[model samples]
Each structure stands twice: as C-alpha cells, then as structure tokens.
Target: MDISMGDEPRRLTSCWLYWIAVPTGDQAGVMATLGLTQPTPVTFAEAETIIDEDGHGEAEGNPDGLSRVYVSPEVDGWTLVIGWWCDPCDGERDDEVLRRVTELSARYGRAQAYYYGAQGDGSAWLIAERGAVLRRYCATGEAEDDLFTLGEPLPLERARRNELGLSSSWGKAVGNDEGGSEWKSAAFHLAPKIAAALGISPLALTAETRVRGTGVLALTPQGAEAEPVT
Candidate 1:
C-alpha cells in the first residue's frame, strides 16, 4: 500500500527538501554523517520500510535522526535530495541540524534547503542556499520575516517589499482548505517563482522551496503577475 496516500499514519508536522550539488552516489555518506539509520536511496519500498519501522518515533527523540532521504533523478546536472522529520518543534537543535546539513552539503557543492512545519500553535517555512539564509517566514506572535542576499539584491529587495503577507489571516485561509495540504502545495508551487525573482534557476531552488503569504508575484509565460491567496 502507498503509505503517503491512504489513512495518514500520524500527523505530519514537518517536511524538508535539500537540493545538493553533489552526485546521487554521495547521498549515503552525507546522511550517515547526520546520524540517519538506513540512509538508503529513497524508493517506494524503502519509504514504506522506514515508515513502518520509524513511523512512531518522535522527532525530538528519534534514534535515526531522520525519517528518510530521497535523491531525485538527476536533473540539469544537479541532484535533489529530500529529508523528512516528524513532529518537529522550534529550538536550537532544529536550527543546528539544519545548519549542519546545509553546511556539510555545501562542502560538496552549492546546496539549497528549506523546511515547512507546524508547532503547537504556529507554522513556519524557511529557505537557504549557498550557505546563506535567503528567506524565512514564521506565523508566530508578530510574524517574523527575514531575507538575505546571495549576489542578487534587487530581487530580494522586491520580494521583501512585496511581502508575501503570510500573516495569521493567510494561515487561517489555507488551514481551512484540505487540512493544511493546500499550504504545502502552494508553498512548493511557488518555488520556481521565488527562484526566478532571486535571479536563479528554478532547479537552484533545491527541487523545492517553502513559501508562505497572502499574495505572491508569480512569473507566468505571459510575464510576471500578482497572485494573491486571499
């Protein structure tokens, strides 16, 4: 049975994707260093096995430290690596883990990583690439926002000025539809647009980037257009 489909085994509180510039053959070495048990190439069967074995493990105490690692079929000379952590919470541990993964992966080549997850009362999404944090969105008390530069400053400025507006209202809107799946879908869908605005190839988005907001400017074939969630 497809575990990703069917009755959800548990509340999926966190998901992450890493675009590593390293070859797919290097995935095992990278993951092993991160303390992930069974750090095998991702496949339907492998995923099922991990889920069956580690599904009940808590994020804060999972012995494996990672649920799974997926190395996407090579595209445009880059290999996309994805990771999933369950029931994640905000803290130094999470930050350190993300930092280590990105930093280590960058040693091999350019790496872009992002994560999306909800805590007890709020949700957030973050993006990083080339060893610098590109964007961060959190729907906590005051809705913190952060963006950094990686050579392209104008686009970052534009995105910041535009401000995706992923405030509490936007979260409520997406949460009401499809049990929060819409938010994840929208966040992934906006990756390409965000990359374009950053003047980078969509693939440079590390196969996926998490974004949140009420409105976003998407680049259509016709041209750039304003897309508002509300």
Candidate 2:
C-alpha cells in the first residue's frame, strides 16, 4: 500500500501589495481620501492573532511595531488589507484597485508604493508613486526569461540588483541562482528609491518607522462615507 502525501499546499501567491508612506498623524485623512471606511484598531499582538487565524498566505508584519491592522470583506474578488506599520498584503490588480492605491499613495505625500498581482495566465508587479507607474514587471512564461520590464530602469536599478545578489540576466532569463535573488532584490532596492523619490528618508521605509493609522478602513465612492468593515 502506498501512502502518499496529500496534495501540495497552495503557495501564497501574491496578488498586489503596496508600501505607502503615511504621515505620522494623518492616517485618517489619507484613509478618507482613499474612500476607505473607518478601521478597527488592533494591537500588534492582536494583528498577529488575526493573521494566524484568517490570513490566506504567508502574512508579514512591520517588525518595528504594528500600531494597527485593517481588514475588509472581500470586494469584487479582492480584499483590502492595510497595516499602519507599513507592511501589507498584495491584492488584485484591477483598475479600481490600482487607482485607489495610487490615490492613497499620493494623498500621503507620495508614499512609497508597490503593487503585484497574478490572474489567469499572467502575473505583474508594479512600483508606483503619485499615480504613476515607476517600474514594472509582467511575466509571460514560467521561466524568468519570460518576465518583461516596463518603464526605464532607475539610476541604481542595476546596482540594486547586484546588491541583492542578483545577476544582470535577471528577468531576462533564468540564471544559475534562479529568479529568487532577483525577485527579492526588486522590492528591497526599490523601496529605498520609492522613499527617495517621495522625498522621504530611506530610514522611513524600514520597520523602524513609527507611522500610525486607523486600521482596516472601508473604501466607498466619493460623496459617500466609508463604513467600517465589521
């Protein structure tokens, strides 16, 4: 009798994630501007509990200190997940989703931002600011070579790749190290650039940044008030 391992667990596929640099005290305004509803406040410990209990994939938190965690019911096949400390999950890359994320980032004075998503036969990631797509990647095939970049490379884009232990062939083709280093480095280096472009200090992008916000606010259309997600 062959006892086989059960079906492989689904990898936590990232949809789209963003890093917004909200001001220390203006989270409410930013949320409202994004049409998000008032959020439920959860302490770092409580946030961890929620992630362990309800999160679908690998959930990460801002190590510095998670002031609050926000969660909204699934909307249009996607959910709005926000953390005041900086780290948040990716979501669907719909136009509305992108528009909201871009709006929030800009409202918060061009906060550091990133978005990623995978649907059907394609996957893409974006580093954006003030409603502009700064750098992006779209996967064509399973191979790293299948991935394509959009927008011009940043001045330090190549150097960032090197720092992340990635090779120049990254995204062009699968290298000996595979796409692991390249993918990881993309965000690591890109974060600093996002902060810099927004005129925010690099240190602000780290977990040490002490930003705060109302957690898990709801987003509604203009001329309407956002309701808190229960």
Best by lDDT: 2
State the lDDT of candidate 2 residue by residue for 37-140, as single tens digits.
53555433344344332223333322212322344222122223443223322223234444655676565434333322223233333445666756554332
Model 1, total clashes: 2
Give me the displacement of residue 25 in model 2, in angstroms. Answer: 3.3
Question: Candidate 1 — worst ten consecutive residues by lDDT sum?
Answer: 213-222
Q: List the residue pairs that clash in candidate 1.
A: 165-214, 166-213
**Residues 1-230 of candidate 1: C-alpha lDDT, one tens digit per residue:** 21233222221112222222333334444444444342223333343344334333432333343434444333333333434441112342446545654565455544444333222233333444555554444333321222211222224323433464333233222233333443434443443344334333223433132211111111111111222111
Model 2 segments more than 4 A misplaced: 1-24, 57-92, 115-125, 138-149, 163-230
The lDDT of each candidate is 0.35, 0.39
**What's the C-alpha lDDT at position 51 in model 2?**
37
